[model samples]
Target: MEHIVNMKSLTTEEMMKIIELAREMKADGIRKLDRTYYVSNLFFEPSTRTKSSFEMAERRLGMEVIPFAPESSSTLKGESLYDTVKTFEAIGLDLVVIRHPRDKYYEQLVDHMDIPLINGGDGSGQHPTQSLLDIFTIYEHFGQFEGLNVTIAGDISHSRVAKSNAESLKRLGANVTFVCPEEWAGEFDYTTDLDAQIENCDVLMLLRVQHERHDGEGLAFSKWEYHRQFGLTLERAERLQKHAIIMHPAPVNRGVEIADELIESPQSKILTQVENGVYVRAAIIKLLLKGRNE
Candidate 1:
């Protein structure tokens, strides 16, 4: 069984193939994927975009989705994750999508499951599916990944999206840079001067202040200071290249991470990312099922 647990586990060719499939799926519009298979979601963490988008993707692909609500599930009664997953497997689910709040949490379940386990998000670890959809969105806009300067800003230390995007984009030959406060920005290609780097980069990807993780204490800066220094304010937005694009993994922090006005602007690809997410996820689900058949 093939599981998308990490972006680094996929080759550049494989990643590109998924993007190509997503583009085709988008162009082709609605279509049946498989009628017999069932997909399940077990999200231990709270989600709005990823959860809803994955469910939408499953429905579009003709799969009967069993969304496991952890709040009301046996897990709430102190049932072990292993038992819950085993119960699902015993009942004959074809695949499972898990989102846990513990880093490298899939280690406990991956070895035992007969079916594939796709990591929707695993705490401070990588979010491979998000990275794949991000790559698709970037490729759709630029037609290629090579030589594109992609700068990811905000909450780098706690962002699974930043880590996955950095690893995947660099493997595909895009120059990846992290912009954040000195405390959060470590050895990677990093910058504190967001304004200086704004004009040259082809993509300015901003991340949310993940308060849920570490109570948003990654940096000591106040909201105003952080916005003034790193947030994409109106003045900073004007400095972006004509063809540059802005992207964020949704439920944006608004004025704290990015200016509220830029959320709906032409240069912002936030909505486009949300739209492409369904197609990319559909492609991923289709690929994993196809491999099992083969």
Candidate 2:
């Protein structure tokens, strides 16, 4: 069975194939999978877009989805994650999509389970599916990843999306730049000037300020200060290249990562990203299932 733990697990060809499949799926508006598999969604962290989109994808593909609620389930009663996953396997669930708050948490479960394990988001580790959908969205607009100037701004250290995207985009031939405060910048091609990046980038991807993951000492700057320094304000949006676009993995920290008006602007591809997520996830599940059969 094939488990999508991170973007690194996938080759460039494989990523391209998945994006092609996603595009095909979107254009056809049809689910082409056999619909014989059952999948479980085990999310230990809170989510709005990824969780719902995955469920919608499963439903569209005609697969049985067993949503796992860790809060109310045996996990609350102190059942181990391993045990909870094992129980699902025992109940005949064919695969598991997990979102946890620990880095590389999926690694621990993949070997212990018989079914395929998909990483939804493993706490500040990697969000491969998000990156896949992001690439699909970028492709839909820009037609290709090669030579595209893509800027990822804000909260880099705690962003799984940024980590996965930087790796995948670079591999796909996009010039990836990370823009953030010095503390958050970690061994990347980084810049502190958001305006300079916006002027040059074909795609400007903004990440939310991950206050949830902060150690209280980091991101010490005020929201207004952060906005002044790095946020995608109206002024910055106006200066974007004629063909440039903005993107965010939602649950946006409104004024921190981007202004509310900018999110609804003509240059914003945020909603498109959400919509493409469903198709991309559907394609991923179908491909994984096909791999199992082959």
Candidate 3:
């Protein structure tokens, strides 16, 4: 079965096709898809954008959805993701949208199931769909990713959104940069190995860290100081390429990673990203649920 766990897992053509389909679906009307489907949202962590978007996407397509929250579901029974996936399989689920707080979180489930799996996110390391919708959403504004300068600032080592965006931008030849401190930088961090990857970048994306997501105060640095060093200050954000865009996956820490002013600025594509997320997810479901036996 096919799965979407990361951006690098898809060819450029495949990625574009999905985004194009999303736009087409948005233009036409979601109710036009003829199918009865059930999608399982197996989110092990808290998420509003991803959860609600996927839910609405399914509804717009005239499909049914089953959701799992840590507090409201059998996950509280200490069910493993493996077992949960099996249960969904037994129930005849068409697809599963999964997320967790571990890096490469879906690696273990890749071969365990027969249905297509759409990875909502795996920890902070690879939210592939978010990055895809991000590019598609930006295209509505800038036309294409070429020559776009996208700077990703914040927890470079952990942000799957940042990781996937860096690769997506690079694959499309957009200049991408990592703006985190040296202590948390890496080859995949978009800073050290990809200096040439960022020059003349056309967009700057910021990632915010939640207090609960951090291990302890000594893990890296205090939240106040993290903001001081790498957070996207208004001045720093303005220094980007003139037409550069600002994007963030929400639940932002105001005044911490991203200044509130920039989030509300015209240059920010944050809200559009959230909106496109629904369309993209609906498109993904169309792909996976199509040709299924009624």
Highest lDDT among the candidates is held by which one? 2
- Candidate 3, residue 105: how far the Cα is off, in Å: 3.5
- Candidate 3 error regions (>4 Å): 189-200, 218-225, 237-241, 291-294
Clashes of each: 0, 0, 12
TM-score of each: 0.96, 0.96, 0.88
lDDT of 2 at 14: 94
Q: How accurate is candidate 1 locally (lDDT)?
A: 0.88
lDDT of 3 at 232: 62
Per-residue C-alpha lDDT of model 1 across residues 1-294, encoded as one tens digit per residue: 288999878999899889998999899885786466888999998888888899999888888998688889999899998899899999989888999998888888888888888899999888998899899989988999889999999889888999999899998999988898877764466778888789999999999988788764545778889999999999999989999999999789889889999999999999998888899888888888888878
lDDT of 2 by residue, 1-294 (tens): 288999999999999999999999999985646656788899999999999999999889888888678878989888888888899999998778999899998776877777888899988889999999999999999898899999999989889999999999999999998999988886666789988887889999999988888867656778999998999988898889999999999889888889988888888999999999999998898888888778
Taking every candidate in turn, the Cα RMSD to the unseen true structure, in Å, is 1.5, 1.4, 3.1
Model 3 lDDT, residue 128, Cα: 81
lDDT of 3 by residue, 1-294 (tens): 178899988888878888898998778877646657777788878889998998999888877787666787676888877888988989988888898887787888887878889899887678888988988887777888787667777767667787788778788877766776675565653453223433365666777674565565444666666666666667666566667677888878888877778888877888888999998988877776663433
